[model samples]
Target: MWRNVRRPWTAGRLYEETLEAAMASRPVDAEARLSSPPRASILLDAEVQPMGPLAPAEDIRTDPATWDPRLERAYYDGDLRAGEAVLELYSRGVDVSRIQRAFSVGAFGLSRLRRMVPTRWSITAVDDIISARLRERIKTYDWIPEHRVYSLEAMGNRWVVLMSPGVWTYESIEAWYPGTTWNPTEDVAFVGDWEGPLGRVGYAGMGGCYYAARLAVTEALERERRQARVLVLREIHRDQLMPLGVWLVRESVRAALRGRPARFDTLEEALEEAGRHLDLPLRFWLRVSETLGGGRQETLSRYL
Candidate 1:
């Protein structure tokens, strides 16, 4: 598979088994130094970058030719809203196999690659697989130091963000269409790094909507000290999104979705309900923005 991983990070079709293989080859914690990352020769730099980072740009939004109609409608209708999206999956009651299936879209969704893939406890079974491999690796070798493994229980698969930071990281992602630059400054997006062991922690960084959409749920889960945020994004990219795109964009949506049997029928209703969960109502922008923005109001306002 290593030979087959021509584009390991982006286009490579990574299965749960692939995760096991990578972990089997990884170095133990003692051997892992403060390195940038492994030499993933299979990385396809272009495909990992999402085309929708420019979704907020007036030029693109007004120009229908550049953006997909369904995508734009879903974005406006709150289908891609953060909290709403995550809760949808959490409420679905699916198993780890589905979670693994969801992540098959080329290297665990760029927004959650580090969070879901390299970490000890993953949102999907792959994390378990990796951990088991790590444990086995330890058992097979005495030199491997005993280290505290890290795993995450995302309440929803759709919302845990892996935001990228810095300009080069964005600009270099020319694999995306022209004029599309990764926006680290927008509230529509947020920050996170790749997932790894104890020493490899994901940091907040600038990002695209793949992770941006998750920022809302990520914050809420962290706020509530809940499990890993769950999600049901049709796909990570905006160009190819799922139908019935109702993003449960806030706390109310999460609660409503978590209610059994999956009650959501539409996106508008989801957004309306999500408003109820907020400290401020949906119609009130200033108040809701302030609450959601926390202290980062100034920086976030520019994007909103």
Candidate 2:
């Protein structure tokens, strides 16, 4: 109709039109673009909190060379659940340490997925499972009547455990010195804490030592048939250049708990006594501690 509607198609106009057309078109894979990545499957199906500690395994052979064929068969059976197998061995009265060693050596787990777990992880996992069980039992018991403090030094680590008469609660505070295992660059003391009923939000900053100490304290409380609010203060000195596995903390606290604890009539007295054994000022510990600091604030509110 007219002389061929002649309009210049400038490069800029062509590009702009093309871009607008493309933008107006529907997405080719809208579903795929909007969807999130699938979540990973969990390996273990057991409850997060342990129901109870495994029964001691009787006459259990820990050495791989000497293990019973039936036990090995049971662990490798496709039908047998890995967590159930672990609990079975524990129920059989197998020492938890032995069970942990078995797991470390790849002696237990699903037949297809069996593999060696790192010793540190194995230790903490076992400790956590057992501690959760103990916590349940300890919570039912009565709280200790008085504040008590226990102190010990070993493997370049000094431990001071202050226990107050109350329902079951625990907190571990660690002071790391310059040149120590995890604080190599620090020029001053560094403090880290794991607190609350839910425990630390993630892996403890002080490593497996936190779980080890928790297990030790739980064991002591279980033995005494009492519950209490526990505060564990650990000081890692500069001399501790080498990383000793958390067993040192576990054993040292165990030993301290085994010995007589210094008695105090009040929480203030207990903290004051524990202060004598620590390098940091008592105020520093109190200020940084969630349990202790919060308790102090609450107490002061009453007087005000």
The TM-score values for the models, in the order shown, are 0.18, 0.69
For 33-117, candidate 2 gives per-residue lDDT tens digits of 2124434443221112112323322222111133444355554576666566666765566665666665554455566566545
Q: lDDT scores for all predictions? A: 0.27, 0.66
Please report the TM-score between candidate 1 and the true structure: 0.18
Error of 2 at 123 (Å): 1.7
Best by lDDT: 2
**Segments of candidate 1 deviating more than 4 angstroms:** 1-269, 280-304
Question: How well does candidate 2 match the true structure in TM-score terms?
Answer: 0.69
Model 1 worst lDDT window (10 residues): 165-174
Q: For residues 117-203, write the lDDT of model 1, one tens digit per residue.
A: 322112323323332233223323222111111112122212211111111110001011112233223222222232221212332
